[model samples]
Target: MKASAGSSSMLSHIAYFAIIILLISFVPAERLGNAEEALILIGFLGAWRYSWASVNFARAIYFRRFAYPREKERAVKDYASRPGAAHAYFLTTSYKIEPEVTIPVYTSVFTAAAKSKGGATIVSSVVDGADERLIRQVFSCMPCDMSGVKLIIDRIPGTGKRDALAKALSLISRNCPSSSDVVVFVDGDSCVPANIVDQAAPFFTNPQVGALTTDEAVDIPQPGFFRDWFKLRFDQRQIMMCSMGLSKRVLTLTGRMSVFRADLATNPDFIKLIRSDFIDHWRLGRVNFLTGDDKSTWYWLLKNGYEMVYLPDVRSVSMETQPKPTFFGSAIALMVRWFGNMLRTNGRALEIPSRRIGLFVWWSIFDQNLSIWTTLAGPLSAITAAIFFDPIVLPAYFAWVMFTRYMFCAMISLFRGHWFPVSYPFLLYFGQLVGAAVKSFVYFRLDRQKWTRQAAKGGQKAPRSTSERLKSYGSIYLHVLALGWLSLAVLYLTGAA
Candidate 1:
């Protein structure tokens, strides 16, 4: 697949350059007016995406290079000198993750718990006795002073993460953590630094800050579609996260690893929201949340006017697996779930006052709603211009896409992903174009929900009736049709079509 995509890109570059050479050599300046007009439209539409990405990449650099280091220095110093620091609770839920992955994950938790010094708790919510035994064995093998560490195991029916986490939160609240104590939520397949508690707990020393999520790097079993795709996506996530962190707020408290004040984590209202989150959509009507427990946590913090921090320097390793070995199927499945969660929560999040969340944060949420249509404008404009204006518009648009997308991949190489990914340009374009369409599909039918990784609890929705299915199909078609009309109308008014 990589070879095929590389070959296709090479052929496209050759064709694009050849056309440019032929046109510049033989075509008269006056006669090239149509192509010039079409090229202007393409560039104008592309400016939106390029500008957004450039600003975000720059903000991320500022956060990582200049801003976060000072915050870390202060936090670390304050932590080292403090006498009576609070407890650290490492709470993780394992449903059916493999033992190979789960072992190191729990080992890291045990190690961190021992490092906390002021006594810590490890809450593991598992389904079976075998898993409980496996966790105990892993805990026993830890080479550290675990006398200060206490392990609590909860047996849960393998329902989903929401239920498991809510149960664990209830258990922690029972212990009644002190004002300064913190709870760390770790996924069963993630390994945190042994000093994660020491590093993150200090940030909570500030009374205004409520939660924080750190940077993540992937640990793949082997190289394949999964590794590259995950890297590309994480690179994007890293940039956006750092950008948001500069605001003293992040979009989502990633479930892979997030730290919250024990007081807020113990709040019954907070735990209840995660367990039973629902949005009353105008069309869909009271859509229940199945996945996206992370979004729920973030929303609770944001609405309550609590400051959330992002620690770019502190990192965790995610042990990722192929949801479906095939790249297309797995990538699409994830985009659906991921975007569905964002689309569901972002609207309600937007309802919060700008004064409450800050102006930039408010506008960023607004952009999330606007970007879906804006992302489609460039391609749809190229098509409209080609039909109504000139055929050469097609080649100009194709050449522009090849140049711009590759430029984007190159620029982001400063962050996480590989510097020289063979098919990155194509993959980036595929993700954007197809991802936009998927967002549109899910936007209209918000009731459609699933988890790509958890096979047992995936697709929790009941079967739809025939008439209900037709209504969904009709809603999606009309929304798409409206988008097409809007794009055409814009291009025509601009005299590009």
Candidate 2:
């Protein structure tokens, strides 16, 4: 009966949100002409914003109360290891363009790995339906002396998006040989630092260390308002969440770059977890729950008492491309998928005997959901507040909210030793408004289950040429100018300026 009550509550919550969204669509703008309508709008928006702020404050307090006591002794001990043999694995799942910038980075990584008495392996897992020419291009970019570094490209049978990644990991686990001690996973586009092995090697000394992830710096400067805003907001959030140790439950270990023990990779159960078809089946309504590859791996390791370490020193640089038109759509889809997956994994975590894992699961859900809700409420609150209050004050209030949120984000970035970009606060505000609007649309459509390949935000095609990239940047400039004009027009029309 208790379980039934909880299920009913969840269903009701979904239904309430659905009804609110539907009502919003039907609300005539003309109806909001009167003071009463304005008051109603103010009440709605104010309540939502306050709720969001309250939640954020609550989470901040909770994190402070349960802050993981950083073990300085353990940190010191982990840093004391002599640089031993290192192994770098350039893991590529897509049959796409041979990344020119990445090749030199890989060469440097391998040289460093070899000097550290470590070996290197290049693993490529090809999707069966991907272009053959693309696969050949990837092969052409690799060094010819395939002896010291093994190259394996397996054609997986499935059309699933993650199938290629699973196949690559499987091949690495099986063919890389037991002699290889460390398995560093780097995506095709990721540039590795020369000192990556030196920074990451110390973590392996601890038996509990199953995996390690490093900080990623966005390579290209953000071109336009949208791209700059998103990059700033995203980078700041990642810094905060990572510093809070939230990445321990990270589902996608960032195909950008990370390192793991070869033994962990070789585990049959780990491979099975990564390749699970649970999500596909669940999306078809065949199952109530699903789990993704990376999440499953973390779950398995935690269940079996293995610890995942994060090293801020081992850094990777990734070139930032313009956001595609489908970028927001893809983000919403991914978040919805993760919401369902987290529910299932958190359930499993609850059943486990360890208190630490249970705590991690609880905090992970709280952190992610609360952050998303806060972002959504930002624009909703601003629009709603405009209805009841003098329109002139709306922009100031909205600006305040944006600055407050950005300040928190900037603090996180600073704590991580990164310079907070001057343009970040404005970009964060714009990005939040756009993201909230897109997510609201997706939520109402109830089509979150469908999978769509993401396009570049500026509507540039993949494998963008230099000229195309330049054009996309120009488009961004035009967009910001248009938005500025629109904002001024709205202010004038509303008699708010």
Candidate 3:
């Protein structure tokens, strides 16, 4: 019997583009343009990404719409009556978030906690006393049955997320009822989907699935470029996550909302790692994790061989604010923080061999490192061709990019359940090229970490000690060297040098 499920990739997917290029070559024109080799290289990279993305996109849809439903049903049915204590703990951390965002968030949370079967605990880890008061007021005003629910206020200094989470985890560990229970972490500005608990808690019934994170959508009250940008990002996230979900693992247990089995969440070692996780850089000494608490949890789960699920249908709506005044500024700030977290853990995570971590999951992590280089290849190649080889290459490159990216967006929109905005193509390329640059920057300066939301206070400045200063200078040299080599290779490949 002939097989048919999976076939063709990279060049196979973009043969039509090649055919179009070939057809263009036959036209009566001067110089035939410099798009041949330049586009071929660009075409291959784009095709590979789109090809891989297509596979993930399909897998994501199957898992979310069909496969996951079957597995979830089996889990719910299998463990329906075999449980002992099925308590859930809602651990929410709200620090410096506005009242308007916090109130509705806690209200939805309190309601979710109250509705769970064996009762739940709401541990509000707050920095400001006002946040605690707001939470209490919301809990008090809630109309649901409060008999089985327990409320705890974990007040802490405005240190950082890690400290707050560490304290909250300690509280959960101390009062955890049973290993069969679940612990859900909710960010302050996020509202859980209706019946989130009922939908998510059932997945933990599967013994192999140690944790699960749901999809997220922006619910910002104010609308603008930032809002649309966030929407596009979330759309991309949902597909990628769903694709990862198929392999019984996901790259992240996102901070917006994620559920962990009580046994895993309450482990002392796990709590300790969350509180103080650091990686030793060969050159930069010890790099402490100041933010990206979500990353710490992900590394722990992956290291422990825990299976993670991505619940695409059950999504939490997060209210986001632009961290900087301008979109470009805010984007760079977040990407620096975001990609830094990934790069820091990525080296360590890659140390886990494929046989142990599963091949697909291992490759997914490896792809992160590869993407920073690969994403830049097309644009770099296109620019080189346009500058020296042929000016017509620019127009051809732009046209090809617009056409392919729009097609890519249409597919994403089909899966995302929202029509991609007109700016999707431009934003897509801008994010890819700019994001690659940011990733390159972060990969070198992994030790330089700070929270994007916090004010630039004097004490929080990056280390100025001699050793740190020496490393900072080395980072620039290394970044320049890497890009220089990349540019040289692109030139060599394009025959421009």
List the lowest-lDDT window of 10 residues for candidate 3: 1-10
Candidate 3 per-residue lDDT, tens place, 462-492, comes to 5568776688788989999999999998898
Q: All models: lDDT?
A: 0.82, 0.52, 0.82
Worst 10 residues of 1 by lDDT: 455-464
Of 2 and 3, the candidate ranking higher by TM-score = 3
For residues 396-418, what per-residue lDDT tens digits would candidate 2 score against the true structure?
Answer: 45444554555655565555456
The lDDT of model 3 is 0.82
Superior by lDDT: candidate 2 or candidate 3? 3
Off by over 4 Å in 3: 1-30, 33-35, 83-85, 456-463
What shift in Å separates residue 212 of candidate 2 from its native position after superposition?
A: 1.5
Q: Give candidate 2's whole-model lDDT.
A: 0.52
Global fold similarity of model 2 (TM-score): 0.62
